[model samples]
Target: VKEICSYMGVSSDTVYRWVETHEMPVHRMGRLFKFKISEIDAWVKAGGANRKPQKGNSQ
Candidate 1:
């Protein structure tokens, strides 16, 4: 998980927070946290950020 987080340029705490908020794909490996590479891919593809569009903003 640390390795994956490093690859994403985020800290372990950020990943854990994602888990807590159910924002990231993950599973419990027994009593420990586990995340598969596929899961990460899907999560990224599913849109990782939660941003609200600006009012009166034009693209």
Candidate 2:
């Protein structure tokens, strides 16, 4: 999570929220969340992170 946070230039909280709200690609292992740089790059290139949060949704 920390690594991805650094890579994405966002806080850990934002990453978790994106995983829940924006379908951010992630792998869950037990209680851990793993991320791949390639997947993240693709997601960004595809504009997954540019989506605005929906109305009435709180982040």
TM-scores of all models? 0.69, 0.82
The all-Cα superposition gives candidate 1 an RMSD in Å to the true structure of 8.0
Candidate 1 residue pairs in clash (backbone atoms < 3 Å): none
Say which candidate scores most in TM-score: 2
lDDT for 39 (candidate 2): 97
> Per-residue CA lDDT of candidate 1, range 1-59, in tens?
77878867889888776766666777887878777888788777778634333454432
Span of 10 residues, lowest total lDDT, candidate 1: 50-59
Evaluate all candidate structures by whole-model CA lDDT and list the values in order.
0.71, 0.87
Over 19-49, each residue of candidate 2 has an lDDT whose tens digit, in order, gives 8774688998999999999999999998889
Off by over 4 Å in 2: 53-59
Query: Cα miss at 32, model 2 (Å)?
Result: 0.2
